[model samples]
Target: MSTEEFDPSRWDGRDLPYIPGEFSDPDGVALHDDYDADIDPVTYEVVRHSLWNINREAGETIQNLAVSPIALITRDFQTGILTESAEFVFFGQYLQYFSGTMDIFTKWIMENRAEDPGIEPGDMFLHNDPTVGTPHQPDVALVAPVFHEEKVFAWVSNLIHQNDVGGTVPGSFCPNAVDTYWDPPSIPPIKIVEGGEISTEKEDLYRRQSRTPQNLSMDLRAGIAANERAKGRIEELIEKYGATTVKGVMRRLNDSGQESIKETLSKIPDGTWRERAYQERSMTGDDGVYPLELTLTKEGDELTFSNEGTSEQAGAINQPFAAWRGTILSAANVLLQPEQMGATGGLVRQLNFRPEPRTITAPDHTAAVSPSGIYSNQVSLSMANSVISKMMLSSQDEEIRNGAMTPTSAQWQCHIGDGFTDDGEYFLAPMTNCMMGSTGATPKRDGRFANGHMWIPEARGPNTEEYEQSWPILYLYVKEHGDTGGAGERRGGNGGKICYTMHGGEMELGVYTTDAIPKTPGLFGGYPGSRGETVVLQDSDVKDRFAAGELPTDITEIDGENVETVGKGPAIELDDDGITEWWWAGCSGYGDPAHRDPELVATDVRQGGVTVETAESVYGVVLTDDGDVDGEATESRREALFEQRLDEATTVDDIVAGDEAVEAGGGD
Candidate 1:
């Protein structure tokens, strides 16, 4: 796993060893023009490794630097704070890099790469193109390259999911997208910084294009600051350990990471596991059903994922092949080896991916990929499910229920409009953070109610009050729906709630989300989670209540079941989706109800998450005169219910067929 081991066998003939017109291998020698070429190869390698390590460390530190004041933002790829040079587009999968605006980023790189003077040490580069180094256009990246003495050593990058970019719809993400030009938040290659200075012209231009300029500007600034900090740290490392040692450490880090992955591969039972999941047409618009198929192979210590047999969707579920491959690998490594971080590390070495074009994960650029962005998280969930159901199935874990790591996924969008304020001053703002869905629960714990994606650690909820104060929308309550989690011995997580009030302004609202519907399924007796929704609240009576002291906070009810009370408009059933109109939390449960502790079920009821009747019917546990469990009665009821549940499990196919027959006969 050293430079010597990097031979032609790994070559796919996709691209040559280096840029056709540029140097053979940019990483092989000193990149800065003023650097001396007489340095020994051994010394040069050491220097390269040191810089690479510096970049790696920086990457882990500044990854989720939320500077999107009112917008989505993140770092750039390949370019690190310590390895300043011309923009290196990587000329590969852009969406895989989690960057925003693929076409914009590629154009930026090409323009900057051609500059004779070249980008400087402290300069920050920005772009977001799937073809360049990102998955979709909404993800933005800020990158910097560090130089030492006179030689370029390493790179630093940060990635972020922006809420919106101009597109055909309010949310920058258009599931029906047919052309790249229709994509929102598409930022092309442009030097927002030069010699550590922010260009006013570039800033204004960028702000003008965004509906949420305030947040967009803030995120842009944050990305710049993060890169600057990365640059400072790299310089300090070089001054302390010298460039050679740092470079050596980086090379070792990558090699060591690869070795660790290979070892893990060796331990797995060697065989292919073929698994497939579906994104029903109900959730994917006119697009037919989309399938995610995998053939996992383990050859001694080498593991690969072959997606050759998967079919493609005509709708938005499709994604760029290269980016999809990287995303799948990322999900695999994240679940199996989270300890190994970095865009390039052990995960990249021990794995191989085969995503043939036209499949959902490997679609043409012109095809809609919004569904890919929405349902791609299933990759990680399914991989975790397969591994757990196989290797860990016999253990206490027993099933894949609660095996997924990603709790909630999101899709954010923004709308742009022109209008005058109450004071007559023209103003504009973009919408963000309006959509999110919870993930399936894990074996050990409940998935977080509504939360961020697995790849995003610190992607947190915005301060609602603060958002209202700064923007033209009134902040609503952000709460978790009870019983929204899947039911199991270990239940999955629930989703969060959001309510926004419109102020007197003309603007577009943004929505970014995944798993909004078509639940993140649970395994081995666990139920699937709930979907998400976006709604506009309109009612003068409700507004009047808010204006009075009667309602100080925003409130939105998430109805999971459609049963209505005699007095109350609709009896809120906080369980699974069943004729429920409001968006509820996810239903990610594990194990069977019979396995649940009677005491825990009682506590859940006491907390108002479940009704007393539901506990009695679902758990078959009775309450005593003293409000405690009637042990004798409960025992008898449990035995009877257990038998019934077992019987119900046996005739699931018949039940499904009966339901289909009833539906065909015009039954409710």
Candidate 2:
């Protein structure tokens, strides 16, 4: 039983394993299954539903998809049809898993394509060049190619956000970067692997330019391992089903996605919805204000997401055409059937975009598109947010609401390498921070708090004890910053914190950040969440230090008071009082808070999400000390404030619905 022996076409076409109303085609026979064959008329009659969860999931995976866009089609080769299934993340965002998985595959494919092109079917490749396969350098991909009967069938790929790929800065994402050559280590799509073996020489070339070679190598290795796993699983699927059935299913899967898109297009009013907006970069690159304009033309069963109006930025903020398409398609899926699998290729036919190079969204070959030093993800999110705002005007989807939301993004990093301690023993230090921002208000709910990086999943639990015993670092404080969440139906969740002290031999640290000032905006009437910051400590005082600096030879945490900021000698505090606070920009609010439920307000207060003062000041909702809602007071106040506008008053049940929906929508 060799790994490549599976074929999907040999299955006896009896009733395949079905999930009733759910879609499942593991064996590839479903390629011929009529679209209406498993139909449940009652379940199919629904006209309105939230596709937020699915769309968000797709967003999470889009980066990974772009890293290995070509490899995503392999599921069809193995299963006899391309089933729109992707890996999942703890936060339920599909893009994260998709990107991670695809990253691994891209590397595998690049290594295998030339050497074991036939028998070694599950091999992949890794590269980051526009001419060969990918568009830019920061977006490195891991790809794997699938084969049937020694014939190449399909592929899988994943992408990761590398802060630096050579270049002038510690992180390669320099906003000031003008040309591709200015960006360091711009890897063209050359095979860094051969016959499943990674080229150490090539890897060394990458490490020479990267600030954190150990971290880069570790992450890259992880990606390769992930793709190997995908190859193993996909081959198993083919072995269980037969190649013909798998191929048929793969083709049918594309058909199904296209059909789903068509159905969604038909439901919307047959008119074009247009929106114009600009996306600003946090770090000013060679150019200023990388204006990203979006023009969405929804005509009947066809929709086009174009970035013709966008202006190119200095560096990696510029996205490739395929990557841009992935993001636009991801946003569109939110407005359509989010729960369905959005496979690559034909499923994206209905959605198209203009590929004018030199624009921020679709830059020319000479443009620097690395994301390490620049705020690339932020740029993409801003453009997507603009489109969402426009779509909400014609639809009831509050996810598109930009008024209540504030725009912000955060930067966090960890260092893991063979660092020596006092006794010269090897150690690894992983530092993670909560780079948070505001969120928009949903239809019936309040805005979410301190969420940064539309793509970052939750950080693993803080390793305080691990730091104390294994490494020479002090974990001073780790908690959520109070009053940081934005105001809305419920105030947004607060951002988490981290304070550490360095010791032993001098160690090098890397910090990646962006959206430093203007926060990522919120939707509806919800206010944006808090902004994020990173600093160092000498004594009890906070010190303004650059990321490329070295740490002291010894250090320790004095008290458990959880000092918010650290520095040398004098203890420096973050003066949130107007000056410093205003320095950190918050996104705008979404809808009106008066429309939120009083009960929900009470719960938020109990959970420490909203303070009594903010409740009174922002949402105009009052509560009792026992966390009970003052219904009479609430009703009268809401009525007076909203001028008897019923749409502004969300009931207790609605509040519950909104909260539940947020959890279901998949962000922590």
Candidate 3:
């Protein structure tokens, strides 16, 4: 359908199809008239734990086998179990966003290949098309069907972010692309494995399109292995408990998730909460900021999210309907049902999305969405959290208000480079410095430093030693930058900074895509974090200084032929003597900085998380020479600061003054 013709309102009332081995809707629907049975509590618990453990094991298998740092180090992958009807049953604790895409892919398989190739034992399907529920090109999904008594019982799925997928850029992030055609070749929902054997032609075709064929091949194998492991575990469950009981247990799990979410919603006050977030464009000449607006309405036990006034689809930053929906679901999972298992399809059924098509949230099929999973997904997620947190704050329950989590930083900071190693090995490396940023501050506590991205808290970057060994780069230092976090009563955590230079080879090509504007803004009276930057010093005096056993702590100390500041742009070549310095953006704070404790401000200054001047100016905290807070001086300075703020504050007349007021008064 064309973007203009699509209407999300039509998508709201569609009935969920009833299928065997899947959970029925909470409205009490059945797959078949004769298929009604009660699950034994003992058997239900056993099957539930089995499914959860299977997903966990499958994730471990992927982590063990995958060669890409995105998988092994960053944990940018997920494993899940689905019913025969393609309902999500259980998923691993990896990237929470990938939890919903498996069902979409499996359902497509069932609808398209029900009688053609057919869903049979040992069969596996592969897909990565954004139109078919994938968020981006690199996140490839592999699914395998589990058979019981010659009928489909469940499906096991695995998704992983490939190192490269043959896009305009080596890492599949095409900042220069204006359309989907510029991205890696889209793979439709198709069978890549049949009867437990890989299709050589299909596998070869898939691998041939990637820039790093060897790494992609290994990731594909890892996904297949994970799916196989899930299949075996499902079969074992069937062998232990009869098919009928297993199916009943699956239904119960869904019912539990549905009831839990409904209960949470009922306790929350009914109201409409709206919030807006923006994506800073990375492509040159695209200076416009794309805004994503979200309106969340809560009534009784149902929640509806609408993106009616968001920006239209443009650039490569757009997201498809599936990704938009997934982002909302992920946010809901964290805010409402965080303590429960995410396998239940009931939560997905309970919520509704009213996204106007042609917007960045619901882009046209032809639009490029290469960065949606990391960039736009983060935007959508933050917007969702912003609205939800507002609702929680308005609640009468003190626990709920205090437990709310403000929006965190998104994936606006990244650095990718491709070059040959010292041993003549070509390498495409994505710097993991983006993963070391702080999380958003909570209502009652400060944010966590080096806490990784908000989407995947479990994400981790490789050590300096590991990076030095893997690529031809030398890390001068990697640590938290001083005065980087957003200043508040409960300040946000600080982000890290990294300095590196070529060891034995020049960086033939490099891509620096990050947010020149701060993407993570604080809530209430808290200040927004600092924006990240990429500084490159070409033909520097690093070798001479290092040879003399004098290491420069800052980039200013290094003499260079030319100094260039690359801010969110396309790929460029780097000289051998160039030094690249990257500073990650900090997370948002929770309250006004002036309300912060003087002693705490002194501690922040001592730890290098805040400058002494920032402590004095922002927090109004005067520190003594020995790094201790001067209580008497701090009180006087704070009073003066408050008076200054009152003096500089804008009055109502300033807004309605001059020509605007004259026009309103009809004086022309």
Best prediction by lDDT? 3
**TM-score for all models, in order of appearance:** 0.71, 0.63, 0.91
How many Å off is the CA of 383 in candidate 1?
Answer: 6.0
TM-score for model 2? 0.63
lDDT of 3 by residue, 457-487 (tens): 5677778887888888898888888777788
- Tell how far residue 405 is off in model 3, in angstroms: 1.3
The whole-model C-alpha lDDT of candidate 3 against the native structure comes to 0.75
Best by TM-score: 3
Ranking the candidates on lDDT from highest down gives: 3, 1, 2
Cα RMSDs of all predictions? 9.0, 13.4, 5.0
TM-score of structure candidate 1: 0.71
Model 3: number of backbone collisions: 0
Span of 10 residues, lowest total lDDT, candidate 3: 12-21
Worst 10 residues of 1 by lDDT: 567-576
lDDT of 1 at 472: 56
Candidate 1 local Cα displacement, residue 193, angstroms? 5.2
